[model samples]
Target chain A: MWLRSHRPAAALMKKSEGTRRDFLRACIAGAAVLGTGGSMELLEAAEQSSALVKSRVVIARDPMLRGAGTTVDSKRALNLLDHAMQALFDADHPADPWKNLVRPGDRVGLKVNALGGHAFSSNLQLVEAVCERLQEAGVKANDIVVWDRDTEELERAGFHISSAPNHVQCFGTDRTGYEEDLVTYGSVGSRLSKILTRSCNVLINMPLLKDHDGAGVSMALKNMYGVIHNPNKYHPNGCNPYIADVNMLPDIRTKMRLTICDATTAMYEGGPAYKPQYSWKNNALMVSRDPVALDYVGWQAIERKRAEKKLKTLEAEKRAPLYIATAADAQHRLGTNDPRRIAVIEAQAGR
Target chain B: MAREMISLADVKFPDVSPINEIARGAELGPRLLPLDRRSFLKCAVMAGAVCGISAFAEPCAALLPWAGGPTQGDSQFTAEARFYEKLQNKKIKCKLCPRECVVGDRERGYCGVRENRGGTYYTLVHSRVCAAHIDPIEKKPLFHYLPGTLAFSLATAGCNVNCKFCQNWDISQVRPEQIRADYAPPKTVAELAKQNRCPTIAYTYSEPVIFSEYLMDTADAGHEAGVRSVVVSNGYMQTESLKAAYGKMDAVKIDLKAFSESYYRDVVGGELKPVLDSLVTLRKLGKWTEIVYLVVPTLNDSDSEFRGLVRWIKTNLGVDVPVHFTQFHPQYLLKNLPLTPVPTLERAKAMADAEGLHYVYIGNVPGHPAQNTYCPKCRHLLVERVGLTTGQILIRKGSCPFCKQPIPGIWHA
Candidate 1:
């Protein structure tokens, strides 16, 4: 219904010739001044550029966790995380642009989203496995900091409180004015936590896959809200452009090396939380360097879950994955909603 | 012709919450304090107007117009936030808004600030400023506070909302790191505003709610230096944090997007109750509160809605609260729509007047007669205005010169 209302009734405008070059030029120029220009303008351009990069979402079907029975074993989660990471990044360094940025001794900041408790948050086992792999790949454990917005939530999700000196320092930005001095958000001055913006050589975006009440789906880009202190202010007119725009910020996106979304127990509706009745435990993990594409596939999975339950469609709920289109059409980094350019692969767990 | 509904079989998986009895509030770990919506409004309205938080509003105000410029100095932007819980595999949940974002190992929040990294959530825009500006206090449209004075404005990237017709979409609609940012610390912002002779620092442009921490610190500094503060914001806020900050500023301007709940849900993605609650709270706190209602053609400019809004303001906030119905320009995602017609703005002003709002004015249309402030009882122009610059005030000690009806505002001798 939302798409019906918003889908430009007029035929889509043809991509103007040289538009891609113009966008790329703008992006390069925008990136050049990332240190000086206002963060919001950089975000706007990047977001618009990301939206222009049209990509397809692919969900690997044929359940992998179908046979794994009953037991609440933590090891299974680790296996899945390891499987997903290896499948996505492989033994080889990420291709092209990312290949040059990621390396050993890089203080890799593992950006995680724990808005959902145990049911819907990133699996600790997966996080540990991935960190271990990073260490194996030459990144130091002490250099890796697993963080979010609140220490309490971290504890609630069974995260070990890491205040020990020299260990992977784990702390929340919620501690008195932690994000208070950070940059502003648009004309709206938004403060972000210093940990995400000020301290980290490389960032690894890790978000859970879930249906969001406001945005159609919450993915890697949306996970950045934990970087800032006040998110309620941005929840306007469905948080469409702002959420998409905020995700494009250079401080958040530029420092990031990859996006990896967790879809093991995908929440289809009424989520960001685990709804057992409405949840679909596909027990699969998804990883990608492209945040937009990662979320795109997750959105499709959510739509499928809703359909099976006879629940309201994203459109019926007055919400849809409009940001994906926005991210694709943004700076024209991605094509015009075409899946051909997006590489979708399926890999099984290997010994 | 109507189309037939599709079968459910072809549909895909939906994002649904667990119905298990265990999947209640504890799973999300509610950090949001229990405060009534109205109380939250009060906090939003009073933010930065009080002493300690006065510094927070200054940097926000100064950063608005200068978003595209060079970083002033001494601010490095790189780091991540803390606070989140990791689940199985690589999924994480953000504990920031009421919407606890349960993200996989690699994801972000609905606000686009927090992110999931290896099963942990981290903030990404720390100290990254996207926009900055210095303008007259009247530009913030905070008429009731320091009239004719100037303010320093600032903002970063990212908002919680996705208003299709956002004027500042270039900035307010993106993440902090996506944009270029300047390094203007609270002290630098305060010094700059002070150097520019701005008595009050204002946190305007975009939504100040998203940058609470930045605004808070800026407000603190401004107060220490004897500079007053103000905030122009959409009053959607969580009460606990807002109250803690409200005790630090001098004035506030709340953008009442619309009066109807449906309008808020569809067009603003916010609840009307929160805004109304803020206005009432501002009134009770004795803070200088003004409201801006941007009149979008055919969207929020309905006479009935304006009338209802006026009635509510009169009954709840009293007739003293200044209400401005500004004209809207077609931009951003809503360019297909036409600019708000001048007549629509006139009608809105009339509706407010008819509903007994004493200080209703039309904005964004310079040189209009309604632009000047008229005494509620005497009908005398108390303070004149031409765009953002203010003219002579005919009132002495907050009273009209012609009829002596006292005007309510922070007027100087």
Candidate 2:
């Protein structure tokens, strides 16, 4: 039941293709069992199918994304995002995915990552495309909020502050502050940003993929670190259980619907700060409903780039992103991090 | 789901002013404004007379002002920090505390207030007074030091160690810029203490060691103005730093969290040895020292640990050094734990007393007889206290009225 059919491509698959798919599914199941402390029952409960519980991740790349200057091509980036969404949902029209993601009355929050600053931040163009798509799906402009840790960082990253009633609202947690009540989960204790607790019911995580000195990767799961009041306290011991624990908070785990990583430009080393010398243009936007799978794929992408640059892998560097596997454990069960369980649909935008 | 779409303009935004706006005229760094006499008097009266520990009786509402603020600006005057040595590649190693965080350029230390910017180290919380109040020295649990007198208490955000059972985590665990603060220069703090009839200035609430420069400066100013400075701290600092800082302080109460190194490491994120060294350093410097051990049930309230703690104090610091067995209420990350039993605190006090440590007291239990200071010689109540408010003092010229046995404290007849 966990392996829900997405497209008719599965029906017309060749015999050899089916066999390869089964082999991949078995590998995924085995990995899941090992990751979850050999708890076959939890794995069965999480992914009920003997076949792979396929999580579709779309990596849509546009060669023209990096323009002559440092600015991104907004039109091309929006086109790339549209293609990614359409492919992710396997829908006939691009708008169908938007409609499926957000209902007309849903109060949507776009949690954007701007900690990487100007050089490596969530693309404002991608954010604009998301707001436009949400509006096109009959969501009110006022209901869509784009936010990060602070408004100053958002402004520094080229996001306009629109707190007006008739526009897509843009502000940070600095505006709303945090809930007075502290939420305790595992080793994590924090007051969640009121933006997540009080205002929005649906959340879309928009993190910029980058290298982290401590967490190994700043992706979807780490993006939620911004939603809490105290992130500095949770940075010890490679941010393993803290990252997984913070993501498992009821308000976050329940409301977070999708993760769209802005990977057009990423840092392979010396990040989550924006180091120009360590930066590279991947010119890709990754889309996924499973945050763990998306982060796993992002981690692989950063490792691949690091390998290309003749740099040590995150594991070799002794800062592996262990939270991804921890999130998939029996206690959390947030999502799967197994590569065989993740079907990454790579496509060139504007094809 | 039909949810009403609330406008952003409708939401009541917390104050987003930068901390520098409030911390304007502190003398440690470049002043936003010259110190004016009228402004000084006004601020002194506002900070000294009006504010009290009762001002924060409702902790939640009081913390709202510090919940959110504007991002800290790089242009804010940075006070060059002490106890740091420059390293290669624009790095610096912080030696203020035992953590010894080796910070790179544009990185902050473990405390989050000290930063390494372009190879130079600076303290962002130098003169920033995030919380201030007028409280009795007994509130600091320094019962033996200037009993029943109010001390002008203040603190800046940040702590060297992260205690899971921290009662003041809202301020201690946050960055300086995240909270709203006011600038009260050292001279201003001293003047305020003098004007408000307070005999002492207390560096309290948060770990004062993180703000050692400011604390030392304020202590010097207070000494010049005939007011003493007392510190309420976790006592997690380098030996040299401790000696230098405690040399200026009049009295110190160290929150000795636990006896075991494992407990200090796993629960408090610090080492026990440095804290012990700090106690010894204070004794060497001839600073009046007190110890408080918050007894959490089943965690740190065992017999062996209590015996070990008191034995160390009896051997190293002396039996005359006052030790308080305080009750622990579940807080911060340890909310699932139950409150420390009254019997447990009594048991700790009894054990410490049995271990030959004089002046042992039980805290957080008002109306308990152990809260009073009894003469060890005559077994007569010398000073009766209920909570932080001291009642009858039967001591004359620093001795018990009945037995004429001298009480070891700053006793003012």
True contacts kept of each: 0.04, 0.16
Which regions of candidate 2 deviate over 4 angstroms? Answer: A1-48, A67-69, B1-78, B85-93, B102-110, B115-121, B392-406
Chain A of candidate 1 gets a TM-score of: 0.75
For every model in order, what is the number of clashing pairs?
Answer: 212, 0
**Stretches > 4 Å off in candidate 1:** A1-351, B1-107, B114-127
Q: List the DockQ of the predictions in order.
A: 0.05, 0.25
- lDDT, candidates in the order shown: 0.61, 0.78
Report the lDDT tens digits of candidate 1 across residue range A1-351.
011111111212222245776546444434433444564465445545544433323333335443466322355555555455444433333222223335677787787777666666776766776676676667666777888887777777767868575667666665423442335333233556677766686888888888776677887767886776556555544566666566665576567666667666677876555556657677667766666677666777788778888888898888886767766663422222345445566655423
On lDDT, the leading prediction is 2
**Tens-digit per-residue lDDT, B1-413, candidate 1:** 11111111112211110011011112222322353555344334323222123332333333333334555432254344434567765577554333455664445666666666666656554445555544557667867666767666656666656565666654565555444466656776677667777787777555666666667777888888777778877777655445545546688888888888887776766678866766676677777888988777888877678788888888999888899887665554555676566678888888888878889887766545677899988798888765455677777877898888889988861
Instruction: Please give each candidate's TM-score.
Output: 0.51, 0.83
Note the residue pairs that clash in candidate 2. none
Per-residue lDDT of A14-106 in model 2, one digit per residue for the tens?
A: 223557656565445545534546545544744665554588888999887866776777788889989999888876787878877788889
Q: Judged by DockQ cut-offs, is candidate 1 incorrect, acceptable, medium or high?
A: incorrect
